[model samples]
Target: MSSLQFNAVLLEISNQLSAEQLEQIKFLCRDMIRKRELETIDTGRKLFNILTERGRLGADNKECLCELLREIQRHDLSDKLNRFESQSGSTDNQPDDEEKAKLDIATEVISENLGKSWRKLGRKLGLTDVKLESIYKRHPTELEEMAVELLKEWRKIRGAEARTEELIKALRACQYNLTADKVEHRLATR
Candidate 1:
């Protein structure tokens, strides 16, 4: 289509939804990538990027998305998409401030990597280069479980005095979703 045609199409689609709906579509596009069993997170990112390139979800695009949702057994989401009500975002698959990521680690691995860099430890623990927030957002249960295991192993190898910062940096490459209340803090006494 010509530029004007394309813009018109996008505007029409945009008019049918809210900003929150757009973001839901973006997230659904990403979830579709994972459901396809593509290994990399980049697949989801690319799908979202393509949708944004289209500028909005046209009727055909929306239908295609609903079909994909059905194929993935997300009938509720499919129904939601079908109605295209003014609802802003998805009510399901929402991650938890509730589903806290438990750290998972192997005893031998943790024992051997006690003094290594957090990055190195992350790699060794199979957290690899993926960000923790992504885990908390997209794959909450899996990564939270991993976090729990890692913390358990940390206490096993490094003892109770271990800092949450240690786990934060090691697993996420930075402190994330961590606060003093979540951990027992150690104060320095002269």
Candidate 2:
């Protein structure tokens, strides 16, 4: 059954209980919720049995029952607030390291290929050269973009025919060229 419906029933029970009996009920509900066993129909049945057996849900127990219901509602509301904060990412105090590394690498690669020294690039990007270098070190995937840019620059300098021939030789001698597949495999194995 829904938590709201269950809560309504608990409230009804609370109206018929005494303060001490309500405390007992609150303690039991807290224990059940903590154990993750309070969501089952059988748990509700067990609760009802306990109340009936103890004469805690009768006319004499009304005040206690109400107090217990309030406690349970308070606990439920606290749990809901916690969940909402967590889902909204408001509870995460730290940035994801891996994601930050990737972004840093991408920025470094772009700066390198664009023919700007890291210090110059850093000035333009509003970061320090050391910070840019650190990013490249952490996420080497950035090298792929730099390699592509290097090839484009080489083509412009050496002409298409020479650049194509050099690339073919580099591909064949995998050790000589920093290709994406080889770099990725090396990184993964390391």
Candidate 3:
């Protein structure tokens, strides 16, 4: 049957369903819609198959089925369908190795810049220099920006002799919670 006709049938079925049944149908439809949008037809179809196998889409829930079909059709999951088809060897839009390599290099550059920033912050706070995972746990937001700022400051102090008292005073001026002794220790270790 045409998708439009099928959708109409589904909507008619939905109108006759009780509130709980309607909710169940809505949940199923929402999930299917999202999967379809993401070009995951196999996943969506598997879910649909499960519902049918469980007798959730029996004669009584025909309206629910129609409603779901209508919603899916209305949302135009055709783009997702095309994406799935292409991925399954139906299209020539795939990225080549060189493009993929470039993306990988860019990703690494961003990661390294972020790492340098985190180590600088760790030094300033007298904290242990930790990996990305640990840094994520401590400051999840604006991490990249903070890291960049820390790296900039580190460059400014890179060639200078250890000015522990001056550095501690500067940190205090900025209202950072590090103490003079801790800053001294951190600078000494560096």
Give the per-residue lDDT digits (tens) of candidate 3, residues 1-190: 3344444434443343345543444466665445443343233334444555656553334444445644544221222222233333423343455533432343233334434345544465343333223334435676665553443333223322323344455455544434434544544554
Compose the digit string of candidate 1's lDDT tens values, residues 1-190: 3344434434443343444554455455664444443332233334434554555344435666556445554444445444433222233322232222222222223333333233344454344243323223333445334444444433433333344445544534433223322332222110
Sorted by TM-score (best first), the order is 3, 1, 2
lDDT of 1 at 128: 23
lDDT of 3: 0.41
Q: In each prediction, how many residue pairs overlap at the backbone (N, C-alpha, C within less than 3 A)? A: 13, 12, 7
Q: lDDT tens digits, residues 1-190, model 2?
A: 3344445555544343445544455466664343343333244345655554556543234344444544654332222233333333333433356533432343333334433232332333233333344334444565545444343333222322332234334433433233324433433554
C-alpha TM-scores of all predictions: 0.22, 0.20, 0.24
Residue 9 error, candidate 1, Å: 18
Compute the lDDT for candidate 1. 0.40
Best by lDDT: 3
Residue 23's C-alpha lDDT in candidate 1? 49
